[model samples]
Target: MHLSFKNLFFTIASVFGIFAILILAKPVLIPLAFAFLVAFILFPVCQKFEAWGANKIFAAFLSMLSLFLIIAGGLFLFSTQIIDLSENLTEFKEKILEIFTDLTLFINQNFSFVPELERGELLEKIKSGLSNSVGTLVGQTFSGTAAFFTGLITSIVFTFLILIYRDGLVNALVQFFPENHQDKAHKMFKSVQQVGQQYLFGMFIIVLVLGFTNSIGLLIIGIDNPFLFGFLAAILAIIPYAGTLIGAAIPVLYAFMSYDSLWMPISIALFFWVVQFFESNLLTPKIVGGNLKVNAFTSILSIIVGASVWGVAGMILFLPFSAMLKVVCQEYIELKPLALLIGEKNYTDSEKDDKPGLLKKWGEKIKGWF
Candidate 1:
């Protein structure tokens, strides 16, 4: 047996084993991943502080302080929005009940197999869902307040430690490579830092822009609570494709019920479509760049896999992490094929039979032998 094949099989098994370990150690690793992202974003700022003669610990402390303030401010705004929205619970309930009733009626009218639901029973279900959803999300997902705080504090501490030991971390990673490959390993880490900063900071800018645009559009369309819905949608866009759809769907629904004419809903839908189009092609392209380097299919697949492994954290972290993996792969001759697999570059027919394509021909040859 060729040594190369043995190495390939060992590497594949190692990857599967690592995945199992990740799932088993998720409670610890998830926070660490979050910390790494935070440290990446804060790296430059920490450097400046260090350059000014601040100790690593103090530099990390200052950086973490600013991050905390920004997060607290955002949360405060969200809390206020929720509070104000709660004041309109009665109106929201009526609107929800109306939509539910009409939906049930349509279903019954369209489907012969469906039993018709009375309006009273339909309203009861809708009300129950609305009341329980908030509790379920906040309580069940976080598994109570203690777990949420633990993760938050853990991430913060990890970020500080990462920022403080940023250089040490890089050196530690480089040590894993042979002497001849040490330079490439260092370059890979540098590229990952650049990717992380570009991806995360660009996302922040895009979110702010989307929030403002969504709010202005909703205001023009005369939707109630435009700011609340707009920013909420904008924030949701952080979740990628599904978030944007869900965000727009909320206002579209509100517009459907708020106005007498169908034009209002149509207008809101069209507005989001245009905004999202420009966001993808213009805003994201300009700000985020091709840092992720993966295609849409890979991205959506990562989200599914990430959600399976890490839940919400996976969906948010996996895309960037995949890009990081690609960077690391590109640094190694043996791993370059894996990098190509991870990337989204279009290939000509001639390129299709490249090194990795050997596996395809090998499979076909096996069939001939069979």
Candidate 2:
């Protein structure tokens, strides 16, 4: 058989062209992606309601309402804690500065041989840079907030429409292809939905567990604002490894500054380490399992790239998006290799045993054919 260079080039170009479109249309695509994510997450609830004799439109409305209520309740509960934190910002800043000064003095005393390590100048430079960065960030935030609200309104409308006519949309998409391919398209859509639903539900449980554990642990460790820290931890937990460490810093620093003894901060750190240990070994394996099984390295790399591309929203959405991408590729014969790279190793003994035997069988078959 002859290789079709023309077909190969067209395929490669089409793939790159789509990627280019995604990047170019990111302003629009980001909100659409977020709407899809919200719709995917609430799909199971809608399904259950539908099964319970509610119509699709009514079920979708109820689900969306439930989602809104949950969000609003959380915001109300956390509002006071956030306000308290903001009010104490000056105190936190002073405490941070004092700690920095002490650290600078200690470093100067211990590392006097390093003449270029002038703590005062370094501190001044850092302060100036931080101030400038903060000013720029605030300006960007104001502009971004306006855009975010606009997007939120649009996404809500889009989600409502999607839920109301999800079946119709699916039918239209399936019909776009040939009749023979329609079944395949429908199967692929179902697979994607199943994977997305499982991942979102599992992640929601994981986040709640982590949040509650963190809250209780911080309170036990004598952190003043346990709830706020817990909430922070929960939000951060969405991003995997990086979120946990970053979330831990709030309570640890609070403990360090508020308490006279270092033991408080030390205890807080130890508590988080223990909780994380349990989460990784017990909770995650049990709750999340091996489904949507992305590799740890890929998770981290995706997070970094996602954060760069779409900020916090990107980081939160990237995992499942990547998982869905993997599922799509896994369904295609030509892209299975890419899926394997992103996926976890098959550790089942049967699969492991079959690997070498399959290789030998293939070799023998090739020899016989020759």
Candidate 3:
């Protein structure tokens, strides 16, 4: 009993210590974490260039430059789309006011016993609240913008350094373990690298497929700025359950505001539902693969924990981080249960294909009779 209590105390203390450190050192640590992910994505390209006879430094530089160009171009396009969207803010505001008017009328009609406030009074209260909070909002926006740029610069620098000294880092990590376990350490390192690369590449492909499909569907439905909403949805889909709902809501609300017909908004919702269906059922299983799949409950819990700890960056980073954790867990005998707890049920292709139902057997028999 004493030993068990001692172990429990130490475990709790260790967890709290780690949490405190993460919260306190977020500014530096978050960027370093992001840099590692960037390095994982760029590592293969760097290796390819090196294999083609370029020096490691030059190869890293070239890979980084390529990534920079892709990001800058995407940002340029997104900024232009946002500018176009902003130009119609007056129209959007008008629609919002109309929505509030309709909502107020509906509530007043449905609940005659409830006291009704004047629409102008409601608007006045909202305006006053906004005016009072303006200063706080402005301060936060400025601080956030500064922090974003700082993190971006730090991550870029760190990514380059990581790519340049990757070999040394690997050796250093391996040496941290005892001499006898060095081979296992190297294997774990390779596993981490491969998992990170595969997961990131798979996510990239899913995003493209989702974006294209979403845009095409919206365009066919005759919505304005289909590409813009589709792109936004694709990006937001990275956040899992909550993100898809929010992403779909944006387009549905826009469709309602932009179109007089109720069918347009309904159709928009249905389209997203169908896209999400394909995504979960077909795209994800086939592309992302079972290897990186986390249990649904664990994934949600991780996202909540990550968001509480580190905000939006944590939400984006935690999935790959969790997958890496699973990989690490699998490397140790004692941690195998942890890997299983967080992972999805794995089925081999033969097992999946070998399951033939009674209906299938009957159909085969009928076909043979015909």
How would the candidate models be sorted by TM-score, starting from the highest? 3, 1, 2
Question: If scored against the real structure, what TM-score would every candidate get?
Answer: 0.82, 0.81, 0.88
> In model 2, what is the error at residue 167, expressed in angstroms?
1.2
Give Cα distance to truth, residue 60, candidate 2, Å. 2.8
Candidate order by decreasing lDDT? 3, 1, 2
lDDT of 3 at 259: 82
The candidate that wins on lDDT is 3
Off by over 4 Å in 2: 1-15, 48-58, 101-137, 345-370
**CA lDDT of each prediction against the hidden true structure:** 0.80, 0.78, 0.84
Candidate 1 has which clashing residue pairs, if any? none
Tens digit per residue, CA lDDT, model 3, 334-353: 88988988777543344432
- The reply for model 3, stretches above 4 Å from the true place, is 1-3, 77-80, 101-116, 346-370
Residue 325 displacement (Å), model 3: 0.6
Give residue 97's lDDT in candidate 3 (0 to 100).
76
Q: For candidate 3, report its TM-score.
A: 0.88
